[model samples]
Target: MQSLGPLRPRSTVLVKRPWLTKPFNWRALSSIPPSDYSNQSRGGLPRFFSETLPSSKGGVIRVQGDEFWHMTKVLRLKTDDRVELFNGKGGLVEGFIQNIDRSSIDFVALEDPKLVLPQTPQWHIFAAFGSLKGGRADWLVEKCTELGASSVTPLLTQRSSTISDNRVERLQRVILAAAKQCQRLHEMKLNHPMKIDNLIPLVAKSKQSFIAIAEGTPLVSALTSTTKESSGLIIVGPEGDFTEKEVDLITEAGATAVGLGPHRLRVETATIAILATLTLWSGSQQISNC
Candidate 1:
């Protein structure tokens, strides 16, 4: 038998590198676009979402799936294209595309992200989903994301229809797209559906809780009377509205009944009304403080 010397590992050769040749440049990454979106952010640069992101610079961030498709195929982004990335948790960063493949985009973040502090008294909505038909729920989710609500949860009630996990997932997709469109540093949340019984306990423990009903305190007035620093929970039912027993459970848990107006509103309309009112109210409150 022939004696062989200790085997050495084979060296691998590279033809083309997928990553950017030049080092990451914060300035280039952040270079401003034309004055089209003068009010805020880079106009030329598009935004994408990665569920979580690196806190500081030089970390490789990979974006995949739907976000990746939008970046490459849909948006036709090329290597070295500047773009903004945000995590749903109040994190926003500017970076340039360093590499791209069939399924993912790799980029490096080299600067501290601009952090957006949550609005004072962040508001959340717990709405009944069973009766929302013909894409009403999707519209609600999209609009809520744009309007800057903290989170939205579907509620189970006697008169409401049952929502599937698949439907909730669909709403989540809407949230992402809308967040990107509105340039939110923090994406609006879409929570798993909860039963009115389960919600009653949460409502009981909440400092500010309100319910929409036929006769009660005016919506705006109710919000105005609350302290500025209190986070709120707003509950709205489906088209059929909450059953007598469901209302009893919710209200007994310390939810203040609030009326929208003379006219009755659908689940989607009423929920939007509450959120829109809250948005305008929050802005005015900030101005007053300033």
Candidate 2:
């Protein structure tokens, strides 16, 4: 009688034990301890830097660039030491020294690291600055990247002193170092050097653009409203400033020439002032959304 009828299929639902479900929820389902999730939930700064990288492919990385020299020679790090690492690609990891030799050292990746995204301002600043000599342009690029310039373009103007274009790699190194120091996950871009006449007409065609000229137009009057797609390009000139012909050309090309401040500034100083103003403007716009 028991074997006469066909057996019905059993349900595939298995009850999970309390302990099993609890650990799985805490570790697999959710990240970090529930009590400490306040900051993590709100997307605050990550606790660890480059030191907590996991052993997975691409999760953990090593920087053989000047960073290696800085780590070994400058910082005098040795085996068993720990450090945090970040690749400009938004990957952060914590790593420990596995071995230390004369030339290079191995850092063992430990835990799965959390990637921290940079809160880059909504707007982008393309600083087309006239060339400066004696590493002044290099300094300009470094500070600009630090202050949140999305990109930079070196301008070979009528008044420029330095025309040698051999410092691109050096400028990139400075940008990378600045990004790392500032905890900025976004990479700063450095475009090729171009003549002011050529770049202005090309850029002036954009929907959102402005040129910073310390005398022609008032700064406050230019930024009357901040729309979602608000952006501007600041043109900083050499010691003697942009040639009148160049200014005329840009003005004819539909670029809104704006001033920075009451006092005329050096090229480097002017670039920083413009960048600071733009950064503040971007912040004000972001807060206005609330």
Candidate 3:
């Protein structure tokens, strides 16, 4: 266990303004042309698709579904158009459109596939959050993927909102879109919804785990003091926060009860804050060691 010393209060004032009040750069906005595959930069901003195949020299792969539609009908790409392909299993290949048809497009690998290894120590944030309403869960998934959470699991807590199977599917799609935008070679794993009690034993065995609470140790202190080889889970409560019994169960199970700051953060805000803090803390620790 690590000591967080004393908790302190922090505050900031935010101002809101209308977008129309700001000066507009109409020319700068107008200068941007419509997106076309031909004008796509070479080795820069290449469109990404997920099609796993042999990475051997000159291997051919096929692109279909929404990806094929976007490349052909939407972007109007034709033969010889270059694109980047990843399998979300550490494979990244540079390929070019070899042929386009009514249903699919063929791609010819132009170079040997490159493997993007996971970060050192391979820290994984197993975010077990309650089901959020509307787009909140979707936003959380997208941001978590960008923040490099290895996996995210929706927790079924006593106070958690209802999460349908279809919602899980939608969240998975959000993860995929975010991964493509972030150019992540390895996709973030979105696990099925699980009971919070089921997560207790796993937390006890985790290399490191923290539960975000309002009146606990400061997260920064606990994280900075951790060993460089540490990697584990983070659990966040839902709207109205977790029940007292749930809190006791997690704390007793060996998870450190941590706090972001003085303010009570919304579920999505807290999720982002926790992930962002851990990411920065890990990166900074690595740099200092070097």
Candidate 4:
């Protein structure tokens, strides 16, 4: 391995944040990606997402297409601008604009890019927000990504409204933007829309699983015994909530039903609440996954 010099602090950390508006070329979102929809820029350096990075130290990594536009136009970066780059899979490197143009930017890796694998025991959230009114579903994904969830899968139950592929692609952009903002190493993954029946095997594969239900065990109390770092799954129902048979099916597949509170919560609200509570519980148990 080649020895590397210490990272240089950016002389000026641009205050301008990347424009993350959705539907900005939906095709670009489908083409590109982000962290749990989040990441925190280190050393005050601006961060951007790339699909791939160079294999060896001092390699050349190219930024083009929407990514190129974001850097050149949105961020208005110039040659020699010190910046950080990350691939969604935990690869990160500090490099400078070795060259630039209207079409693309080329970065010269200062040090070999390093890949940090995501920790074990990822917590995957399955939510039925297909029918959420307005942008609540989008908001739920944004916040969840910022919180560093392992993955979010749109759940389909008896009450779930049908979701289109285009919508999923739209959510992908939200995920990308959030991951970049939080400076998360591993991009929080966004799974495809899944039917309740399809989730049965996944539930069993998890070391632990929880389903949110109105008269069930308290959320915190439900996670009390199993916080030592192991993979798990959590499910949230759609508008009318899961039917008794549906809940029973998941429960029989080794999922425990946990209660949020007496008041009924919106689909998005319930999903975020459960995710946030789990994040806190994991922190207390020395297993903060976020």
| Candidate achieving the largest TM-score | 4
| Range of the 10 consecutive residues with the lowest summed lDDT in candidate 4 | 1-10
TM-score of model 2 vs. true structure: 0.69
Q: Against the correct fold, how does model 4 do in TM-score?
A: 0.81
Q: What does candidate 3's lDDT look like per residue over 84-186, in tens digits?
A: 8766655666789888878787777776666544533233443445456678889998888777677777767788855676677677778777877765556
- Ranking according to lDDT, highest score first: 4, 1, 3, 2
Clashing residue pairs in all predictions, respectively, total: 1, 12, 0, 17
Query: What order do candidates take by TM-score, descending?
Result: 4, 1, 3, 2
Per-residue lDDT over 1-290 for candidate 1, one digit per residue giving the tens place of the 0 to 100 score: 11112111121111123344555343333333223222454245798877555445665667777878898999899999988887665566778888998778887775656555554436788888656777888999888777667788887787776777677667777877787786766656676677887788788887778899887799878877876433678899877778888888889989989899999898888988987776676653321110
Q: By lDDT, who's the top model here?
A: 4
* C-alpha positional error of residue 280 in candidate 3 after TM-score superposition, expressed in Å: 1.2
Q: How far off is model 2, as Cα RMSD?
A: 16.0
List residue ranges in candidate 3 displaced over 4 A. 1-45, 120-130, 228-230, 284-290
The alpha-carbon RMSD values of the candidates against the true structure, listed in the order shown, are 12.4, 16.0, 15.8, 11.0
What shift in Å separates residue 82 of candidate 1 from its native position after superposition? 0.6
lDDT of 4 by residue, 1-290 (tens): 11112112112112112222222231221121233222333347888887665544466766777667778898888999988888777677778898886577887767656665464336788999988777887899988887667788888888887677777777887877777777766767777678889899888776778899997898877777655444578799987889999999999998989988889988888888987777666653322233
Deviation from native of the Cα of residue 9 in model 1, angstroms: 42
* True lDDT of residue 95, candidate 1: 83
